[model samples]
Target: MMSEWLVYPALGVIAGIFAGLLGVGGGVVIVPILLFVFTTQGFPAHHMMQMALATSLGSIVFTSIASFMTHHRHGAVRWDIVMGISPGILIGSFSGTWLAAQLSTRALKIFFACFLYYVASTMLRNFKPKPSRQLPGPLGMNGVGVVIGVISSLVGIGGGSLSVPFMMLCNVPVHHAIGTSAAIGFPIAVAGTLGYVVNGLSIADLPTPHLGYLYIPALFGIALFSFFSAPFGAKLSHKTPVVTLKRIFAVFLMIIATRILWGAL
Candidate 1:
């Protein structure tokens, strides 16, 4: 029990660093680790994935705030873009979580694993969008937000892996895209968390230390360290070759995705 206490916070530190460094919400890190921890801790098999997803979103609420503030200090975040897409994100995030509650646990695991692999491949290629069109109007941005929010909520991610690429496609600069994505995570986390909580309330068998589907202990442990470490990652991003780091992180994502797929099968 003591080891788990230490380990969860340590995971938060790692998740925070990665969130800041990559503009990812750390859900990519949090979900898999929680899957392992909950399974080992003898949590009910049926509800473990739901709990993990809920907790991942909960931590992202804090992690995104920390990361976004840090990026805002550097003037990287695009508040205009955030405003344009936020409404769609809020709607889509809640919708996606509701949909996830309808799916089987195995199906959700497979879906998330597949999504991770796609994100990993995109990062590995470092694909840059050609300046094919000017930045979209509000409607188009909202559409993009809907997709990002839906997919992110389903997979327990912050939507950066999808949003950064979409923003680049709209001719936004990479750094600004990353920063804006960090800001976007907040709406996704908030809406998704609420949806999960509501969904869990209808289920009678959730374990203790939970607020709805969210595991309170894990949320506290992860969010606390994540909040502190996010700034460190934000600082390092400027000094580091972020492209290289992103690719390395992508490789790590692929490895984790493979492990998840194996387990799901």
Candidate 2:
């Protein structure tokens, strides 16, 4: 058996690459992987899924930082848009955690897997939205941000799937949209992580040394490698043909999602 020491860092490297390259939160994949790892570690089945969600978001806090900084250095992120939407993101993310806490573990797993399928299919399509208009006003962007934040918190993603499409629809180029999505993920991760932490604090029988629902060791292990690896992916985003890789990764998500769905049933 591979030790968690090895496994978690490996996961971080893989997730960080996906985060930087695709402008995704990497938690799209990280959540399910964490669930599997947590299961192996004998965590309470009752809280396993949410803990996975929380831990995934926690790791993304580190992943998004490095990823966005690299993207920012490349002049790909749109700071104006990130600033405009952040208020709404924080409000929505903070509330979404409470909503997540109310769901049963099985229900949450099913819902999470369904969302994963949606993310995978979107990637496989590689659909670029046709730009129909300029970016919305601050009020409109904030309204959209609320929706993105709520959904992101519920699903433990960094909001890339939603934000990237929204940016493209606003006439941003694909690269710019990806980078901007990475930036946007920062607020989502911060709020989502806090939400999960606060929501999980009252629960009992959890693994110790946790911050709310986050598994501390998993968080640290993933964060350490992701910090170094995200910059590499960010650089690759500018130089590589990420399309093929995204499709391959989408298929991987599909398989893992199916596994989750089966367990939920």
Candidate 3:
């Protein structure tokens, strides 16, 4: 138990660096680790997935703040896009959190596993935006934002996977889209974490050191390590070959998703 508590901070550091470098939600790394760690700690199997998902969202709140600030400082964020998508993200996050709470742990794990495979496949396809001559109007932007919000909220992602592609299709530069996506993560994390916490309030048998849906030790540890590590990851992103990184990340996701799916069955 004592050692498990110490591992949370280390998990945060690793997840934060990945989030910064890949612009992912951090759940990809956090969820698996939490599932393994919590299970080893003798938490009930029925509650393990729920706790993992909830704790992942809670930890994202901190990493998102750090990543968003870093991107904003670089002047890459598009405030207009962030504003346009916030309302939809807030609503979707709440709904998704509620939905997740209603599902069985096995079901949730299965869903997550499948979703991860989809993300990996999409990345491997090297999907690129079709050339567009015109910029998207307000209505078009709002529609895209809504879709991104709903999907991201449900999957515990930061919306980059969807938003970046949509922005590229709409004529936004890749760098700007990535930066804006990072900024958008802040609102998504905030709303999603709050929703998970509120929805989990009725779960009477959560493990020790937990508040609502969140594990305090995990949150504190992840926050402490990820905050500083995120900046470092962001720095590395600029130097690394993006194409190579993408392939590596895709492969990593594929392996994890396969393992998770097999475990669920």
Candidate 4:
């Protein structure tokens, strides 16, 4: 239990830094590690994946806020873009959680692993859509938001992996896209977390000390450290070279994806 305590908090620190650095909401890191931890603790296999996803999204609620504020302080976030896409994000995110609840645990894990592979591949290739035009109008942005929200919620992420790239495609500067994605993460996390809470409510055999799918102790531990570390990460993002950070993150994601794929199979 003591080791669990230490490990969960340490995950938070890493998640926070990643969220600030990449605007990924930290769930890319959080979900896999939580799956391993919960499985090792002899948690029920049937519920473990959902629990991990729920807890990861729950932690992101706070982490996103911390990261967003830090980025905002540096004037990187684009408020207009955030406003344009948020409504669709909320709707799509909530719907995605409902969809996830209907899937088998193994199915969800496989899906998540595949999605991670896609993200890692994109990053590794440094694929950037050529800027062919200006940012999309409101309806187009909202449509894109829906895609980002649904994919993110299904995979227990903050939508940054998709949103950042989409923003870049729209000719938004990379740094501003990252900062805006941090802002976007808050809404994705909030809607997705609430959806998980609601969907998991009817499970009669949930493990102890949980709020719906969320494991309370792990949530607290992860959120606490992530909150403090996020600001530092945000500071570092301003100083670090973006390409270097993306390459490092891409490698990390590939490793995580491979591990998850093995587990799911």
lDDT of 2 by residue, 186-260 (tens): 899999999999999999889977888888888988888888887788789888878888898889889988998
Error of 3 at 254 (Å): 1.2
Report how far off residue 59 is in candidate 1 (Å). Answer: 0.7
Better-scoring candidate (TM-score), 1 or 3 = 1
The parts of candidate 4 lying over 4 Å away from their true place are 21-24, 235-249
Whose lDDT is higher: candidate 1's or candidate 2's? 1
lDDT of 4 by residue, 9-126 (tens): 9999998887767555588889988998898899888888889988988988987887788779999999999999999899889998898889888999999988888877787787
Give the per-residue Cα lDDT of candidate 4 at 15: 86
Candidate with top lDDT is 1
What tens digits encode model 1's per-residue C-alpha lDDT throughout 4-36?
789899999998898777656688889999999
lDDT of each: 0.87, 0.86, 0.77, 0.87
Candidate order by TM-score, highest to lowest?
Answer: 1, 2, 4, 3
Q: Give candidate 3's whole-model lDDT.
A: 0.77
lDDT of 3 by residue, 40-131 (tens): 88887877776787777777777777677767888888898788777777776667777877888888888888888877877677777874
Q: What is the C-alpha RMSD of each candidate to the true structure, in Å?
A: 1.7, 2.0, 2.1, 2.0
For model 3, give the 10-residue run with minimal summed lDDT.
Answer: 133-142
Of 2 and 3, the candidate ahead on lDDT is 2
lDDT: which is higher, 3 or 4? 4
Question: Model 3 clash pairs?
Answer: none
Q: Model 3 segments beyond 4 Å from truth?
A: 131-143
